[model samples]
Target chain A: MDELTAELTDLYNEHYSQLLRMAVLLVDDRSAAEDIVQDAFVRVFDSRARLRDRDRALAFLRRSVLNKSRSLLRRRQVSRKYQHRLVQREPGPDESAHGVDRTVLAEAIARLPPRQREAIVLRYYADFSEAYTAKIMKVTPGAVKAYCSRGVTRLSSLLRERV
Target chain B: MTELDTAAPRENSDERLLREGLHTLVRDVEPSPTALSRVLAKRRGRSGSRLVLGLTGVAAAATAALLLVLVLVPDRSPRPVPVGIAPDSYVVRLADGTLASAALETGEVLREFGRVDAEVTALAKGDEHVYAAVAGEGVLRVGPDGTTRRVRGVGRRAEVSAMSAANGRLAVAGGNRVTLVSGNSTRRITLDTGLVVRDLALDRSGRLALVVRDRDGGAPTLRLVPAGRAGSDRIRLFEPACAPLRIAWSSTGLLVLRPRDCAARDAVRLTTIDPRTGGRIGGGVGIRFEGPIGGAGDVRVSTDSADRVLVSTATGKTWLVDGGGVELVAEHCVVGRNCTPVPAAM
Candidate 1:
């Protein structure tokens, strides 16, 4: 098989499900998130001419997915505002959590500042090495280390305090 | 408290709690697997069919052209107005997005009617005039017979993006502000919006509404404020589970909302909301559609007094649905602005 196809196949096999989950966390909309990941994949597939380095394909996909998530969020904001004007409405009820523990995690993650939440997701949930996380986030490895350190520290302390 | 390095907390501890919560949410939130496979299958089938149809059509057309050449016909000068075709006003959109009109009766006669310096992002028709907004340059007003003038020094260049004309006034929203431009005066309304203004609409009564999104990229807030009045009581209408595909407002108690999943081709869905309550007005509260736009062009949506929606796409096709089921209706090319007359004939 050609290098791009092989690389795409490998990356898809390894990260497809995880990426969908991550998108859900970021957008708070599960269907939108899944769609975002699929779009990221299509974008990567379409970039056959530019992605010559097979090793960097995974990193490219991760970055593209994050960007797509941002765009989706932008559009979601617009839709919500439009809906509010028409209905004179209120924020909908919080989606019920699956389990008690899961609810706690979801609340904590949701409360996190955008950057810190992103750091936590990339470092822990995605299980990327610090170097890989740095590349995906477009930050220095030291910065990635610091984000992970601070994120984990805060997460642990918050959970501990809750207990 | 000396921090104990006991990593595994109780089953109800935060780590386990968070993991469980995330897992459940993920499981509950996945897109339909069938939706994905269905999109792929449809795309492949359509492409294959198109290839075969295209080749056969090309060969048949070529043969027809050859026969026509063999049987030469008399060449007559084209007539100005073709018989039975109604004479209509035409706007030749310039590269800079200006609206210039010409007499359609004069054999497709093209003319530069007006000069709008900026991109004409949106166009709306009024009772006696046509309005075009040049995003920043302000609105251009034109008469039915090609007389044009600018509503000069009314709206700020930096704030205006799109405009909708209602009640003989043009409502524009941009830069955390909304303005009503009339004649030679501007009435400005400042909003405490936490999000950037993306688009705006106006109802028949001139009440204004728009969609704005926060910088953090959450679901956008739709705000409704009194037309030309700022700092009014703004409320949150609905939080779309996905970004909107299209949004339009109608005069008679109808709000059209099309919440589209941005990723897959099957993600385009339509929702119609009650303009006053922001609730799904008809059949069911949770409005959803199964069809996707999938690179469709010339998408046009219109609503009626009964809140029935007609979605027209580029292929000269129309669909009839009661704000939910998009049932196909008719097929025709988008003729131009004058194609549909305002105030449906009784």
Candidate 2:
């Protein structure tokens, strides 16, 4: 194994699961999240020369996953607008009755405006600090706080009746 | 409050529930075991596929050359009647980022203008100079001898979306703002806050035709405004079903290139509209493409003094439209990739 490949393998083994879970929380689609995470790894490998440091590589992977998820959502919105139909995946047989509340909460999170959802995911799911989340989102920390507050308020109201 | 409050308040019940909910939402999610192997496999496959594509591209180029000769040589069809400012050549930014002026019919590069460090977002040509909008770097005016200089007064970091130049005048649209430049006097016109300019055109008489869409996304609308005027003087030209890809002012009227259906982009056509009343002039000519063209910067349309229209896609495919007929004239790829060519003014 070459030096770059060895470095990539180590990064992949350490951070791939966490990034994949983060993407799943952001996009709410398992297959799409997998694709996003895999593509982010491939892109990081392609640009590995610039990201020789482990910390920078991990940061790049997180940013790439977030950006790709945003692009997928934007494309999905455009497709939905033109198709004039909402697409929902049918629940599998293994989903228990307790999964219903989780589904409701997931739907509410998905309904939050894109930035707010991103903020909520980064803050609550990834558990990044406000400054770090703001750095990744390329916004001010105050903006991150605002988005999370607004998102939580909306999500709370949305779940009051169902969850 | 400071930027970072490390000792934040403890989570309330709602916050705890939200956090728990977010965690449980993806509790069953896990990365595929073969994920890293898949990425490596794709990386390896890309390099191998490039070699195969390179060979196929050579064969395709030879076949296309033969077809071009066969189509242009023995045809008995009537020659197109050239109207308006019949320009003989056009300018193209190659994949290597260099600008070159090329012959319209032969696809011959006449002169090589130097490359710009920044990407060229838009291109236009007036009688005396060729104007290129370099992203984040305002616009540059290239003289006849290929000398280039940045035009002053336009914002240094202007993200120019579309540009048109004619009769010693230039109209540049960035965001919802349009800047009209004539001589040394420059006037900036601001449209509604939420409007995003997609494309704009300039007539010989200095009138401006703009295509703009809502920032929130919808079918783009055409608008006509006089030069050096504000949005209040704008007249809304109808909303198009399929988004208008490109618009050009011709001697006959305003020409718009649009896909036949909103959902299907492969079937594109050019329609002539009355500049005054915004009505279609006849059924319009269908532009056949070998493949579906990409969006926005992928397709470009320009017209000459003789009303001859040139359509070029980023794929390096050039089509000539004249007298209600479309002909594929050239297909020249740059660096094994697609290239977009913008026709210059005569």
Candidate 3:
């Protein structure tokens, strides 16, 4: 295999699952998240030469996955508006009481504005620094702080009410 | 797991719950075993298709030339031809931070309107002036005679995020506040605490169409506010799937340029919506680029007197879209090289 392909393969093996998980958190749909992750990988492959190194390629992959998830949400919103339909997922057959709580929390996270949700997921779930999160989101660090603060507060209120 | 989780510090109950919940939420998610192979196969397929497409295009071009001669040379029948009416000129911030008017048909810099600091973030054109929003500085109004002056009232340190102008008025947005300026009469409208303005437009009647996002959470919405009312007295339009990167008011309707999808780069869709009711007017045109055009924030659109739209990107590319179609009019700078006078506005 070529050097670029080999490097990408290594990066994919190491980070695909993590990126996939992050996509799931961002978009909430497992299949869509998988498609987003795969598309991101394909995009990275298409732009591999410009990426130059593994680190940049990985960063590009993360950004691409995030962008794709956001796009999916935007598309879904458009679909919901024009069609006047609601996307309701039925509870799985073996879903436990814990699964219900998880669903509620996920829904709350999903409801947060796009930036706030991104900030929350990047900071708490991905454990990124405020500076790094800002870098990824292309916003100021202060903005990231504000988003995280507002997101956490809203999530707390939402989860409290659900409980 | 990645290095991200390794350096995480201890968290409070809420933070801990959030982190734990996020982890548990995706615990069962994984890519199918064939995901990697599928990607590689798709890549190969795309590469193969490119060659096929290139060959097909050559054959199609030859056939089209033959048909054109056959249909037009001997047959004197009159056929309706689509005429492309290009805008005369439009304003853009050059890579060197200079704002200039460039001819749409010739790609020539018609006139230089002076330069602002490199921190200028947004640009809008009024009836008698051009405006540039400088980061951490107020908006600078450039008159027709090339005089630049900072508009008063908006605080000096206001970090203007978006700006739009129409009729005789200008709308400047910073954080959650929008300031409307018209003939020395400036009115400020503060949005709800967490609502952030993404892009905005002003109709001929002075009505405002704002694309705003709730920082707390929810889809971004298009809202219509009356001319002189507070933001609270606004009507929420439908939340768009592809949030508009830029919006402009045309004679026909509100011109919205958005990514074809959320993950947009190569192409964008320009749609028209009824200013009063947020209903789609018609299937808009799709503007494609050679590659990604920066981010959504970097794309800007402006409508000329004839209602023709000029779309500019931070990557130094510009296109003029009219009833005929979208046409690439200028490349002020290269992508990675000398993109000095990037089109900040127009």
Candidate 4:
């Protein structure tokens, strides 16, 4: 009804999925990421009338998603460690997954530096451009290139060792 | 030199094996519908709130309000010729009989950007050349005279992920590398593992781009390699959580990145940043999500001019957008749609 409410609504409409996608990549949990983005919208709505521009509001949401995602990663990592320790302590049949012809090459990829891993994921997983990627990661295009080049070289070496 | 090249061939063989091995290991790992639906549901709730705003007051007020909100609200958000201005734009349509390209000015049939082909997966346009990726093959190039060239590489197994061309040079994404082919000269930049290249873009300066996935261990990187001999440089673009999948470059060296919803298995968000610095451009670049519009499958970002892009969302919708946001070019676009002529914004 009010200009501020209408604006916040449009901002949510325009950016909800994009924000959630970012949240998913960060959190790795579909349901939680959705909640994170929803919470972001709620934040935007709560500040509706005071917002100066829509672009600013959207940026705020993206930054929020990025922050929330980091926390999610920390949580996922902690749980993963607990699960690993549990498996090691219990010695269950699940341990056989270790022998299941784990693709060494995939493991090498998974072993890349986190920066390189992210670059590879964007370039390969979702398919994006360096400039665009730089935007998402908040870096320069050249830096993005360096990460990929070095990352690929490392991967190549790892793959070679497998052979 | 000679020794490296000799060893390079052996390494190439290994690389090929690795590629095959990687594909085999990960090909089946597509996003699940359940994941996609969950995200889509969230988007609907968010987007629906705004779409519903068309409800109350005067049409003009609501429309203006919507436009402002859409433009300024951020995220997820082209064209042409004449000495410096394009008088007629291209739009493909399945009119009466076959596919046709209708001129915006004359409303007459110009040649179709050609052949129906097997479901074109990607498309790009440069100064005088147009490129499209046929579902199964590499990129197909169409010159100004309508001549076609199907670019080929050493391996037939690599799929063309995305493409960009300008200044007589064309760059294509094959597997994890971005290959630049000019005449017969070919140079390839292979991407790092765990990184999936979603798109390729080239700035006017002949800079090459590889847009990769975003992961959390560290910041996701956007690799900008110069087209010249100096080669690659790694720049941290955004934090790993960004998860950019689709990318485009404007002539001005502005880069457009779109976040993808792996859950919905769709191109969900788009962002524009400085290609060189990776900072948010002062003026906003448009990133429009077209999926919820009409079963829009995959969103493709192609250069409309050096400055703007034409986003064809899976819904058969195309928007002529600038850095600001999605400017409604045409709504309800059908599949196999030809490039439509967009009028200069008033």
TM-scores for the candidates: 0.38, 0.48, 0.48, 0.42
Q: What does DockQ come to for candidate 2?
A: 0.21
Fnat for each predicted structure, in order: 0.17, 0.43, 0.44, 0.02
**DockQ values of all predictions:** 0.10, 0.21, 0.20, 0.04
lDDT of 2 by residue, A1-163 (tens): 8787788788888988888888877776777889998888777765646458877787789899988887776566434431211115455554333433666777777777666788888888878888888778765666577668877887889888675
lDDT of 2: 0.73
- Residue pairs with backbone overlap in model 3: A71-B262, A74-B241, A112-B217, A112-B218, A113-B217, A113-B218, B94-B341, B95-B340, B95-B341, B95-B342
What would you estimate as the lDDT of candidate 4?
Answer: 0.52
lDDT of 1 at B84: 16
For residues B1-346, could you state the per-residue lDDT of candidate 2 as single tens digits? 2223356658776777888777766777777778889977876676577679879999999999999998887769999443221145567777677676666545556566667667777788666667889877799987756678888768889888888888888889999998988889898878999998888888988888888889998888778886556753443456445777779987657888888876777768888777677766545678766777666666778887646688877667777664444656567632233354433322
lDDT of 3 by residue, A67-117 (tens): 887777656644543221112456455433343367677778776766678
Give candidate 4 regions above 4 Å deviation: A1-163, B1-110, B152-157, B214-221, B229-231, B238-241, B259-270, B283-297, B323-325, B334-346
- Model 1, stretches more than 4 Å misplaced? A1-163, B1-118, B153-156, B232-246, B260-267, B283-346
Chain B superposition TM-score per model: 0.51, 0.69, 0.68, 0.57
lDDT of 1 at B210: 69
Residue-by-residue lDDT tens digits, candidate 4, B124-191? 65555556666665676665444667775523345776677777787877656777877778777776
Question: Which pairs of residues clash in candidate 2, taking residues 3 or more apart in a chain or in different chains?
Answer: B83-B305, B83-B306, B83-B307, B84-B305, B84-B306, B85-B304, B85-B305, B85-B306, B86-B305
Tens digits of per-residue lDDT for model 1 on B13-44? Answer: 54444455556555655446664453344444
Worst 10 residues of 4 chain A by lDDT: A81-90
